[model samples]
Target chain A: MSTIVKVGMADLKVVEYPDALTTLGLGSCVGICLYDSTTRVTGMAHIMLPSSKAIRKNENVAKFADTAITELIQIMESKGAKKTRFIAKIAGGAQMFAFSSQNDSMKIGERNAEAVRAILKELNIPIKADDTGGNFGRTIEFYSESGKLLIKTAGKGIKEI
Target chain B: MGIEFDRMNNDIIIDVLREIGNIGAGNAATSLAKMIDKKIDMKVPVVKLVDFDEVPEMLGGPENIVCGIFFKLEGDITGSIMFVLDQKSAINLVDLLMPRDNAEFDEFTISALKEIGNILSGSYIASLSGLTNLQIKISVPALAIDMAGAILSVPAIHFGQMSDNVLIIQNEFIEVLEAKSVDGYFFLIPDLDSYEVLLGSLGVTL
Candidate 1:
């Protein structure tokens, strides 16, 4: 049986081939899916913030893009996945609501996506599929066997990447 | 730091929180009752320290579809407030407010619902300001129709930047319209820094 593991907000999980990883209802939070097709090892992190350095409490490693990506890669490596074979697919990071005068905090979704993009570039991990921004929430599922990510929305319908 | 966590251990402190919720929610319920011209019954607010993981489950798990109205509380206090209604209650409310056959959430329906949220949240915040003697201002209401977890992540991420624990005041309003039942929820979350200013104004300083 291919078990599907759930990754909560500010949380993460790693699974082997034939297994899947999912995260529900992402708003202004980014879901990072890292997969090594050769080993069929996959990892997902539900990151809420762009950087942990800006915040005081730094206990939750999976809560920030900077920390979560690094941590996720390490965990995937431990599961017999090589860093060079890593392919990234990201979803969520949506502006769930619109406001007239945009505040620094209100643009978190855009910020999170940007941060993830930059960090992945620095790490030399090429993103296979990218779906970020807009005013909506997303529930994403990542299949480890095929390294495919599925994105579902309330009204926008579903798409695979 | 927010209100002295040490005090939360006291039963008397919990009662004070309850009183605060009653005053604000009571006013909100009355205004809603008048708007719909229906009898509305409100239960005592449930106040607790909720973790980020438990937030989505507050309204029938994270994936449960809900109509959530978000407001950024500004001025003397800074935090976030959300008024949530399940799919059934959302449809019932739209029908009650606009009174039409086969009401769809067209532009007009959404606008009406946004205004309703604005008015209700304004009243709730105003009541708190009156009780605490604080200058609380609310931002324009933002409405989202999606899964509860997604809707709630906005506030959770906002407050999550500071602490994992968020203080929540969950208020339920029941509308008595015969056998069919309808309900709505108000979730009040004060920013950690605002707690000192909020609690101090009510003369409950430690």
Candidate 2:
């Protein structure tokens, strides 16, 4: 039986081939899955906020886009995964409620998606596929062997990338 | 992050907070019971300071599909409030309130749910205000039917930014005749700076 590592909100994990990493209940949070197919190494992050700089508390690298992406890359590289060979598949970042005025905090889903995209661009990781921006929540599982991201929503079944 | 229950060793303070939950939830339950004319039984409310990861499990699980009604709390304390109901409870509530032949969460059903949310939240806040003497304003409620995790993330990110622990007040509603139970959670995620105001208004020493 393959071991499945569970990543919680504001957390991240890295796994090798034949193993999987999963995160549950991503609302406005974005789940970034990076895979280096050459080494069959996968890293997934469940990021809660767009940027760590805005938070005054001690930084949780796994909780923010800017820092979480950086930490995921470092961990993957340490585990024999080449940064240049890394490709990304992202999901979640949903606007779960409708509001009359779209304030900065209220648009966090869009902001999180944008931040992830920008950070991936800076890191030169090409995004292979993405399913984002809706009024729903998602639970995601990333398979390291095939580098497939399974995105599960409530009514909308499952989609693989 | 769980509540610092160890540090909060004062029984009087804990009792005061629990009383707040009792009054607020009691008013909401009474209004809900009056709306449907069905005897609604409510368990003693539970007040907790919980971590974000454990929140979805409170309703069921991260993947459990639920109907969440969300609104921002303004005035004395800035935060968010949500009323979460499962699909069965939502449909049953619509049946009781609207008494319609078809209960498919059509436009009418959705509207009825929102109205119920509005009434419940209004009564909840009103009771708190009456006890604390602090004016609380509630924004128009928005309803979403999806995974519990998705619906709750909005408030967690909005008001729970400063601390990992969130103060949650939860209660259950049950049907008297059928003995059917529906879990309803009331989350009042106050801003980080509002705790002092809340405790001070309640005459609890910080």
Candidate 3:
């Protein structure tokens, strides 16, 4: 039986091959999945903010893109996954509500996606695929065995990357 | 550092705010009753400082589909208010209001529902401002039909950036019309900085 680990909002989890990690109802939040096919180790983070430096709250490391990606990578490596073998697939950075004035805070979805990409680049991880930027919410499931990220939405149906 | 400083620990302040929320919720129920043309009863407003992750469970689970109308509170107190209804209740409401033969949430139905949310939230805020003597203004209301977790995440992200715990005033509205039941929720999230202003105006000081 493949164990399914559920991640909450602003939370993260890791699983091995034949197992999966999933996070549900990602609106402006980004679900970054890092996997190493060799070791079949997978790590997923549901990041709500782009950077922790911009805010006074620094307690939750998994809640920010800057900290989440680095922490996920470290955890995957500790699980016998090689750093160089890591690749990324992300989903669910959506502008859930459209506002007339383009405030920086209101653009959290775009910012989160950008921040994840920037950090992944800095860490030398290639982003294989992403299904993002629409005005709908998504629930993502990441399978370590196949290195596939499955995204499910309401009207948009589902996709695998 | 926001209101999470030592002030939030004061029981007196929390009780005062809870009372304020009760009054506001009462006003909202009245307005909603008028709009729906049915007697709307609201449960006692719950005032609590909840974690960001746990908030989605307030309505349902994170993945539960819901219809939300969002309005940003501006001026003296800045925050957001959302009137959320589950999918079935939302369609039921539209059916009650428009009585279309087919159950479809078209653009017109959505716009109508948004207006209903606008009225309820507006009255809720108006009552709060009136009782507290603060000048509270509201932005245009926006509607989103999505998962409960997704719709609430907008304000959660904005508020969670400052503090892990968000102050929420949640009220449940229910009405049984013709033996059919309908229910929804009203979520009031006051900005971190606004708590101090609100308490100060209410004669409570940290």
Candidate 4:
């Protein structure tokens, strides 16, 4: 039986085949899913911030995109998954609110998306699909069986990537 | 955990924080009363420091749809404030002023909700700064109608930069005319150092 494992905000998990990983209600936060189709091993990270450099109290490595991605990769590799064989699907990172007077924090969604992309490129992991940077929140479920990532929205229809 | 809790667990500090909530939310309820032309009573609910995971649960759940209005706090303090209402309460509150027939919130109802949040929250901040004699200003309020978890993520991420735990102060308003009530929440988050300033101004040591 396939079970969906829930990932909380600033948390991540890796699953074996037939198991799935899910994270709920990602607003400006980004959910990054990495998968290996051959082994059907998958991992998901719900990142709240773009980087971890600014935070002194950041003991949770899953809280930042730059740190979370690397940690997720290592954990997946430890479970017999190859980093070179991994592909990524990403969602969330929406500008939830629009203000005329823009500030650095207001553009966090875009920065998170950009940071994830840069990190993935630096690590040489190709992105298969991405749904980021809009005025919406998302809940994502990633299945290890088929490397399918399902993205659900409040008003928008469900989509698979 | 050690240092943050040390500052919060002090009896005098807790009493002082509760006093701030009383005065701040009281003024907010009064402003809400004037806007709706009804008798409003303030109900102080949960006021404490909570972990990030527990925050959305306080709003019913992560997936519960809510209308949240956010303002960035500046000047003597740095942080953000959010005014949240469940979908039903938002519709009911707007109906009191604009009297909409449709159940769904359109542009007019949405704008009205934002204005209400702006004014109501303005009073809360004014009272806080007035009490502490701190120079506090707020940015233009931003409104979002989305899942409680999604809308709350803005504040969580902003405050989460410091620690996983942040202070939460909730308020409930009762309308005496129809014996009906509306549930509104006020989240007051001050930056780490600013908390020291706030308490110091109020004659407390951190």
Please report, as a residue range, the 10-residue window in candidate 4 chain A with the lowest summed lDDT.
A99-108
The sequence of per-residue lDDT tens digits that candidate 4 reaches over residues A37-145 is: 9888899999989889977767889999988999999999999999989999999889888878777877888998999999999999999999998988888899998
- Give the per-residue lDDT digits (tens) of candidate 2, residues A8-27: 88889999989999998889
Give candidate 3's chain B TM-score. Answer: 0.84
lDDT of 1 by residue, A3-88 (tens): 89999889999999899999998888999999999999999999999999977777889999999999999999998999999999
Clashing pairs in 2: B1-B51
lDDT of 3 by residue, B20-109 (tens): 889988998798778768877678888876787787787678888889888888889887777888877777777766677778777887
Which regions of candidate 2 are displaced past 4 Å? Answer: A1-3, B1-17, B98-107
| Alpha-carbon TM-score of each model against the true structure | 0.90, 0.88, 0.91, 0.91
Query: In Å, what is the interface RMSD of model 1?
Result: 1.8
DockQ of each: 0.64, 0.63, 0.71, 0.65
Residue B169 displacement in candidate 2 (angstroms)? 1.4
TM-score of 4: 0.91
Give the per-prediction TM-score of chain B. Answer: 0.84, 0.85, 0.84, 0.88
Q: How far does residue B81 in candidate 1 sit from its true spot (Å)?
A: 2.2
Q: Is the docking of candidate 3 incorrect, acceptable, medium or high quality?
A: medium
Q: Which of candidates 2 and 3 reaches a greater TM-score?
A: 3
Error in Å for residue A95 of model 2? 1.1
Compared with the true structure, what per-residue lDDT tens digits does model 4 show for residues B78-127? 76788989888888888766665675778887898889888988998999
